[model samples]
Target: MKIERIYLLFYGISFISAHVNAFDPITTTLAVGIGATLGSIFKYFQEHCSSKWISFNSTGLEVDLENKLFGQHIASRIISKAVNGFMNNDNPKKPLVLSLHGWTGTGKNFVSKMIAENIYKEGMHSSFVHVFTSELHFPHASQIEIYKSQLQQWIKGNVTNCAQSMFIFDEMDKMHPGLIDSIKPYLDYYDKLDGVSYRKAIFIFLSNAGGESIIQTALDFWKAGRDREEIGLSDVETALSLSVFNNKKSGLWHTSLIDKNLVDFFVPFLPLEYKHVVQCALAEMEARDLEPDMSIADQVARDLIYFPKSERVFSVTGCKTIISKLDYYV
Candidate 1:
């Protein structure tokens, strides 16, 4: 009888221990579910709050444009107009089209990047921002047809998904002929066809087609002892447009986008001078977490080759070579 009572006591203790040690499956599941729910709510708020802030603020964008190397006025004006237009309730019903033309290293790509950075929170990495390079994306002339179809579908699909899309075409001077025309439809006016509206989208083209003309104009101003700042859009507008239209190698040479006056701005990026090269060097140095050194910057600028063998007034390679030159100096 005492053994039986001891066994009953041991069994009771064991049962109590099991209840204390093991968690209730339903309660544990509820705890895990609550944690997951809290995490999702936090993520949702984080994304929405950030997006709201970016969509409303333009100060960051304005400052970025002002800090760019060159084409300050034109870039700022056109970009502001585009951004404001996008933000405004009553604005034009067309896509903001900008064609950035200049020699290499003259800030065409830089300006594009700045615009992307300020306009979109994700910048060039944004899912809404699509970049197509001629050499890398559409190299083969024979594949132009396939490229055209793909480009159209891609644009349509993305725009349908999100109207605030940005498309950037780089190395446009190397793009195949008749391929850019595929996008002409999207750029043109359309009154909600198939429930797709592309007016809110932005298109940017970067090309070297008018590089020579721009250099010549700047050179003439320099020879005439005119201030480089005096060189206005009016001075190069006609010549630059004509050059691009006439050049067979240019992607927009025979395209309707040019002929139809669909291109809103033909922003010219002038070649960088010695001072600009120094600035670029300093900027690059600063970017690398290095202190800015005038001596190193000056040496780097002097090492660059300038144009007009006799005059040598401007850097032939512009800021394009500044980074490489800094590698040696710094």
Candidate 2:
């Protein structure tokens, strides 16, 4: 049933039921109807337009990035500050658009989860937080047109329901070209589109599209005997965006999302080192309510494969397999 109809039925029933006597047979039937309508109304508001779900805790997000997330000073800082500024703004120019780029296991999805957890009480499972994976959601290249239409409609409908909604597009590197452009209108700086304002919304794109560039930059910093923390956004942001834009394999290749600068921040997640992997294992153990064992954490981190055989400076998988590795050790 439509939300408007549900609302009318709910209020109308409440009025009539108030006047009905407990002894009347009609009261029981009316009571049943009221229960059904109330359920529908509650669900509609919860899934649709409830601001009660969105409560931005900037301090919590900062703490999460500091503790849960490892070896990503650049990503942790950018995400914390970006989210804080956007959430505090009552009138934003446009929806906050963040494009996170890094190799597998570098905490792109993990950071996304932290953001959701700090924003909505339900975190990733929140109805307002929508995640779409390219390989799963848009598998067929032949159905690009259908995917575009469905994508646009889904975004528009959800935004109309709640302006504070969040849409996360995962596996963006695999998304078909031009398919992402369909929602470009929503990301642009417009007060309203079709009378629906999206300024309060947030869009995050996760991809391995610029992994090579990011890895190379990190590798260079290591080779130079420079601290990874010293390697800032300025070092990789331009190259990352360019490489992603020019690379035909990327979803953002030659896309206006880059050309028009619709992407507010291209957050780079640096590859994790051996120490970071150990930290991940230790953190995972604590998450499972187990005492953190340094010896086991070291064993798990050492077992993982690392690159640059001579130096072995970086974990090839960057704590991606830390969980399963922990299972075997513990």
Candidate 3:
């Protein structure tokens, strides 16, 4: 009887010990899972609630950026690369130039649509990786941190590499000063990056940023001064700068503005496109037409387009370079 009792007690103890051992593992796994879940929640809150996060530069135009700043030759160069040769179906295996322009409502919205709706369906990026973030917003100081982080995972190189993915920043005047300050280094390596990586893209900074800041930049920081402005051009010599960002010569780039600052390349729209843009004004009756000069929109356009620089404070010394290039390169 004593022996039997001892055996029974031993059996009970062994069963309980086995169950406890199994429960140990379950408890450990449960703790780990709970900790992991809390950690993830904390991280998400931190990022989302952060005051400002650095975001990547916008992808492409949501609509057309207009013909005022973006002229035919620039458009042709870009469109050609986009279609690979003006064929209705020409598609490149890699992306093309990054286009930027001044202001909104210039029809810049359609840029990406043309690529995504038209180019992608026809199979443009051949090795066929997915397009991450078909859309993007222009980077602000607020989103720089977040954007830089995202960019690290999505892209491997610097701004010059932005062209590899067809990066463009329209209305660059609004870009944060910090962001512009960061881009100069990247511009220096442009050709090397593009040559080494066929997929490397161009970064076009379209700004309404010019004048005293430009001349000052030319004189001080970049030392691009008179040399950078060149002498042979015609268009910008006498034209009043209509907007802070529009380029008078109207090309995709300020290759002439190279070695200069964003301070240098800005210009205004012409009379040809401003109040004159309203061809229907001719149809108005004499009374209505009498005050056509006084129309609010026209006056605003006039102010924005013809702000005085009588001090000759701002003159476009660079358009000559464009005409010269058009002369030789084309």
Candidate 4:
């Protein structure tokens, strides 16, 4: 299972060479052919199976955050550092637990995809990656108990199959109050739970729970003429966590996940400014295989709403509606 310990083909070829002198002409040929087939099978498995499929490109991720992701410098830095450190560690004490807090269209889901793409070869479609949206997966409050059992089984089954499996939970704010706590054991420091080790797995929670506090902190910086990039985790993390923990409607409300300090990072995604929205439009145009037209991008950005009535410092929906807005133009 270890990467460096594989010697499938070498051992097979050595065995075939050593035994060839002892066999009849026909038998020798058959033995060699069988050895080669077995060797190929093992080599194929080694190359395509779990753990080996992961190729963490930390440099590539940094470049992506710098070039593709716009406006949320704090999020970009925290995500890069946290994921890089976690991925590089061969024996992590616990799973990497990240709770992304921000308003809609602020790149919570986008960043999740970025992380998945960097870690897994197939990106979001990898068999080991699992995504759960509260609205779709856990819609009924009456089925909380059913959800708890099913969720635990699903996590156990997947992690048992691949230790490095990723579980992304979207719409955490809308999730049932006590629903998430069921999987707290998997996220803990324990090396294994019932023979399955979750230390190498990852858990990402995407929510709008602490968005208000995050926005307030960002707006405070803007009003005081401080650079948006200057706002660090120190400025918003404490408030953000507290806001999410206290909000009764927030999924983690009074939950032990935060109380026990199980959440590794509460990354704050700041609201996008007008310029950032324009950047999103330009990026979208490029994504669509069209030239990056500033005039059209500017028009798309202008059509969207901004906040702080007088100053219009930030986009109300960020780049959430940019694609549709651009569709109207082109």
Ranking by lDDT: 2, 4, 1, 3
Candidate 1 segments whose C-alpha is farther than 4 A from its true place: 1-56, 71-77, 85-91
Residue 310 lDDT, candidate 3, scale 0-100: 44
lDDT for model 4: 0.91
My TM-score estimates for the predictions, one after another, are: 0.84, 0.89, 0.32, 0.86
- Candidate 1's residue-wise lDDT over 1-330, tens digit each? 755754565565455445552457765555556556555645554422135423524777677666655534554666667666665643458888999988888887887787777767777777778999999999999989999999999999988877777899999999987899999989988856678888878899999999899889888988899987888889888999999988999998888998988898888878878788888888899899999999999999888888876766777777888877788877
Q: Report clash pairs, candidate 1.
A: none
What shift in Å separates residue 244 of candidate 2 from its native position after superposition?
0.6
Tens digits of per-residue lDDT for model 3, 188-292: 323343344423333334443443333333334223334332321133323213323243333222332332432222232211223332222221322243443
lDDT head-to-head 1 vs 4, winner: 4
RMSD of 1: 10.1
- Higher-TM-score candidate among 2 and 4? 2
lDDT per residue for candidate 4 within 114-173, as digits (tens), equals 999999888898888899999999999999999999999999998888888999999999
Error of 1 at 300 (Å): 0.6
Steric clashes per prediction? 0, 0, 35, 0
TM-score of 3: 0.32
Per-candidate Cα lDDT values, in order, are: 0.79, 0.91, 0.34, 0.91
Name the top TM-score candidate.
Answer: 2
Show where candidate 2 strays beyond 4 Å. 1-30, 33-48
